[model samples]
Target: MKTHPAAHEPGHSSAPLTGFSQCHLGILSQLQAFEELPALQAAAAQAQTIATHTLALFHDAVYEHHADEERELFPAVLRSARRGEEADFAEAMVRRLTAEHRHIEALWKKLEPAVKAVAKARPVELDLGAVEELVRNYAAHARFEEEHFLPLAETVLRRNGNHMEALGLSLHLRHTPQPIGHI
Candidate 1:
């Protein structure tokens, strides 16, 4: 009977980037209050399924985001940056993000086995604490991008009015499943 807001509301400006962020937020909120719902422990265990999906979504998103920056955004901003401390700061961010993506990928690789086991209802399982930690870290990463990286792209790297829209559509199309019978 419970449904997401979007499920009930039609004609919304739906996009997967925001959708995934909201999904993670919903999952995290559920996990935070999990102790209060002992009867829903079985449902909580379904978080293993959510975790697997989250990892795949992030894997695709981050790879595309990094590629977008490397291919278009970063070079544009680098040219506009004041050629000293500001440029250095942007470079630092690029380095930090590149390293962070690798770290996140490594963490997800470790998490995959645990999630698979949980999905199978096997005795092997992910530590709730570790999963929470990973989620929190990713939340911070998303916040940084939304707060800092996106603004930079909008102001400094935007060459055309439609570049961001084009990028958004490209990312949204990735991983979207096609109907099997659609000709």
Candidate 2:
């Protein structure tokens, strides 16, 4: 698949933004695989393997990515907007994205246990419809962030001249693993 031009640009600051886009692409691929694969009832072992890998991808990357945006990026954008010139528009975008995050989290809760069971090779009735809904919602959410939110954030952060560093730092810290005893 062709990567976005922004993804190849030479800049450490853009790494997290590009990574987010790449992550979404990966997630969409996984979702498409899930949607296309035969039901778990038909091929238990293969389905179980796919389920386990997909669940791991979500837990390790997607969930943490969302948390980075919520805990670091969004707040930084809001603060820059509030203090800078784009207060109202940026605030509205942040609110919309945050609400979308909650919706995505709720759908994830509904799907997690079933995925976990399937991953364990246990016989559980999977809600394919809910899975499809989540895929649809997440695709839309990612699109919105990629096309709208991230650009807005970049603009606001750049205009403020300091928030971008903080955004980058927060993203780095979120993705970095802390020592087990450090909490």
Candidate 3:
């Protein structure tokens, strides 16, 4: 994998945030694309491409992105926050965001089989209402983290370079491939 120069540097990486933006935008774009099409038959090249893209996104990147935030970013913020109000706020934010992740994921679980069929260019039973609900929930979740949690995390981590470095490195390492274990 190509590594960014700042991937392990303090205050230099916003990989998690960037990941969130890309995944959400891609998901929303694919869902909206469906709305524009009269029907996404397996026969249409564009429909097939979009369906495949949507399936891969929801199946993989979204889950990994959520895991990255929960495992790396949230802990870093919590570690950096001062005791009392700052710590409490950080904890609360993490709890809310984590819950959001579960809720969104549950929505996806219900919707994934349809997405899978689309990706395979098989007969699809895509439900427009479920798609719309996922779109709305993801948008709101992204907004909350962007407007509230991210700024707070920045404030908490900015005071300590060590904390930022650790967070950055953890994020980088999470994406890095490891050597194969014994078969």
Candidate 4:
């Protein structure tokens, strides 16, 4: 895959969100692999490994993707767009994306306990339903982001040009560890 300049830089705080959105979609694709029958049996063992790596990519991409929008991108565009309805429209889109993230987090919390129980059993047959739920929620969240959020960001946020690259680098610098969501 070709690398976006903003995605690779550590100090660029102006990159448009498409850099992070595409990065997030990549992580989502890897999460789907855990749902496959061949991979499901190993999901528990792979949980820590996948979760650690995914969280790293996710923090730099998804978490900051929203933050950049709420803090910088949306505000930047909202200034020039219509003062009332268009502003509200951008805010509404941000709220929707934020809500989806919360929804996915909620499901992840529920799924964690179930995953823990299976982890205690190790190689034993785990609850496929629990795993399915997490995967489903994450997949849906990704679709929502791609279909709704990215379009608005591309249209509204990309107008600033090269700044997005700087923003992407700054976000990449903030990556950190995340706890596994309880089943």
* Leading candidate by lDDT: 3
Which residue pairs collide in model 2, if any?
A: none
Which model is ahead, 2 or 4, in terms of TM-score? 2
Off by over 4 Å in 4: 1-82, 120-130, 176-183
Alpha carbon lDDT at 9, candidate 2: 75
Tell me each candidate's TM-score: 0.55, 0.68, 0.73, 0.49
What digit string (tens of lDDT, one per residue) describes model 3 on residues 1-183?
988777778878687889999999999999899886765443466666877887789768999999999989998898889999989989998999999999999998998888777766777778999999999999999999999999999999989888888888889988889989896
Query: What is the RMSD of candidate 2?
Result: 25.8
Q: Which candidate leads the pack in TM-score?
A: 3
TM-score of 1: 0.55
lDDT of 1 by residue, 33-130 (tens): 98678756766677667756665675677666667666556665666656677778777776776677667667777777777766565667567777
Error of 2 at 94 (Å): 1.4
TM-score of 4: 0.49
lDDT (Cα atoms) of all candidates against the true structure: 0.69, 0.84, 0.88, 0.64
Question: Candidate 3: minimum summed lDDT over ten consecutive residues — where?
Answer: 38-47
Better of 1 and 3 by TM-score: 3
Model 2 per-residue lDDT tens digits across residues 1-183: 998886677773776778999999999999998986667456887888889987987888788877888788888888887554577778888788888888988998898999999899887998989999999999999999999888888877898666898788878877678888754
Q: Model 2 clash tally?
A: 0
